[model samples]
Target: MTLVSTATLLQDAYARGTGVAALNVITLEQAEGTVLGAEQAGLPVILQVSENAAKFHLDDPGPLAAALAVLARTSQVDVSLHLDHVTRTTLLHRAAECGFSSVMFDAGPLPYEENVATTREAAWWGHEHGLLVEAELGYVGGKASQVESAHGDGVRTDPDQAREYVAETGVDALAVAVGSKHAMTTAEAELDLDLVARLREAVSVPLVLHGSSGVPQPTIAAAIRAGITKVNIGTITTIAFTRPIRQKLADLPALNDPRQYLEPARTSVSAVVAEMVATVGLAGTQRS
Candidate 1:
């Protein structure tokens, strides 16, 4: 009935053998729709703001984050605010200041040592600030200079390396790369279930799957069963949010009010989110 910690959601999913859906939002509509969808499905969800999305708001996501925090507090189901794929330490601190319950500190593109050092610092800051920290160990593309590798076979998270990374960084959750490519327009990424299970066993922390937009429904369920507790979805929300707007614009050329088209797009995103929640087996699963 109110905002909860990301750690609670992840731990609950791990205990239940299910996946928690973490959706990326750009606008307030997306944020509202994400929570509305979760409420409709009677499931708890995480509303995330990505680094690129924050840049779109002029590098200050405070307003949007505050809005999401309010929405979570007033929602009928549990919802949490999280910063996704953050590359800078400043941004991570800003996110916590903005009332975010958790953040994914992205240092996977850096050298292993540098990444470990930076992530450790982030985890320390997060813990001190009362925020849950999520960090990625292997490369999962589709942002910044990593765009070139967005669609390529991602560097799978090494089991041994993952164990060490968690032990050294003290991250609350670990996002693993297991063949899911970011920014995919279609759902066709083939996941390595065996690797997922191996990584789950190797790492003591809960596992996260990035680029989940490219993963189909059945595959997502299978990945969850194999030990993925958190699944991050971005591209599909954009697709769902834009398709109706384009269609409405084309159908009504004289429509001057933005709400006329944007409202439909927001509704579409809500439908997609509800569907994803159900697919992740979170629907109707009440939180204690």
Candidate 2:
């Protein structure tokens, strides 16, 4: 298994009628863990770095992107490096130049016409560089650049607008808002299945479900059945990574070495990723 295009992963999932797991990677450890998780589960995965994570690394994600690219190349399972929820043209270009296989150009918060214009430009440029481009049609209720709000605040993606936006942007994938919120610690978000099915029937491109960390496992599988080909997950994996580290540090107060704790935390994250990959029906899949 070698590094593949993000489009390849999602397209394979769509062909197989399953969903691909896209996890956010914030650190070198997280990248390693994600690749290992996919390997352990024998699934193809998208390892993504969000705009916020890039800024956390001082807006220069070259080092992290390079690291993930290397891991993707060396990993035993199919992996892709992706830049998620990036709005700034400068950052978007930087990510493409840094060897990311794809990028999510978020313009969901912009006015309908402006979003189409900006996203279309990004899609054109991204394609020229042989990178897969994904754009959200409507807001998904999250942080800035991703969705521009928190808790979704009752913003839903209109099926008609979704059709028009996809036709206008020409993105490789379209993230639609049904009824999920970002950063939910609990898996209690109720999805509008009817709306999801309608959008699936209306939009030609593959659909992405944002704020998936809040959706229940069963509901995630249901979303996939209803036409969600890519599921973006973050908070839950971070929580899984952190919870173990907290426990380790509390149990051993004199843990001066970072590896002693981070190793276990990384393993925890890997297990979580593997579980999600299985839940999405991608485990043991070799199409990507």
Candidate 3:
């Protein structure tokens, strides 16, 4: 079989009541590290480049896009490139047109009606081009200065809104904030399992848990059991890889070449990915 479509793989995971980790990549190192992790785990990993990352590369998607495509083709495990948390129409279109298999249109800052309408329009664009659409729960919770909160400031998604949003927008997946905080340095972020369960009962499409890094492993596993089909993993990997690398550099003061230090970083990240994939029940489930 040719490369597996992210939509199909994610849907399968959703059906199996498991969550797939989507790692964010902003640099070649991040891409390499992520692919190495997946290769080590013997599983395909979703390679996501968020709007912020795209902007950092001079408002162009070419470099990151090209790198991921090359990695996807060469990597041992499947690698699906995705554009995450897009807000601008131009960038959203650019992402899909630039060769993303799927993209998330983050309308979490818009009014409920506007969020639905905009997402529907975006979803149509995605559908017309045979791309998967991932929409937010309209209650994006995080400390990102640029990201606006939509589910009414400080309040997370009420279960009813989730069902209505999915029905109205026809999105393939939904990102819900259930007490997990984004960009949190600590791994102590607690998740509201009750809210997650309510959302599971309320929405039919695959449920996405954002800010997932902050939540503990058991809580994340509990969320998987509670019907979360996708887990967005960034910060966890950040802490897992970075902290150790920093210590390594301090130990080896004369090492200038990246390979010397990054090797350990890659190894560390791969271990984390393997455990996470197993914990999320994605191991031994690679599709042909």
Score each candidate by Cα lDDT.
0.86, 0.86, 0.78
Which candidate gets the maximum TM-score versus the true structure? 1
- The TM-score-based order of candidates, best leading, equals 1, 2, 3
Q: Which candidate's lDDT is highest?
A: 1
Superposition error at 117 for model 1 (Å): 0.8
- Candidates 1 and 3, the one with greater TM-score: 1
**lDDT, residue 130, model 1:** 92
- Superposed model 3: Cα runs more than 4 Å off: 145-154, 248-255, 282-288
lDDT value, residue 62 of candidate 2: 92
Q: Per-residue lDDT tens digits of candidate 1, residues 40-154? A: 8889999999988999999998999889989999999888889988997779889778988899999888888999999999999999999999998777766665535533554
True-structure RMSD for candidate 2:
2.8
- Global local distance difference test of model 3: 0.78
Q: Which ten residues in a row have the lowest lDDT in candidate 3?
A: 279-288
Which runs of model 1 end up more than 4 angstroms from their true locations? 147-154, 283-288
Residue pairs clashing in model 3 are none
Please say which candidate is ahead in TM-score: 2 or 3. 2
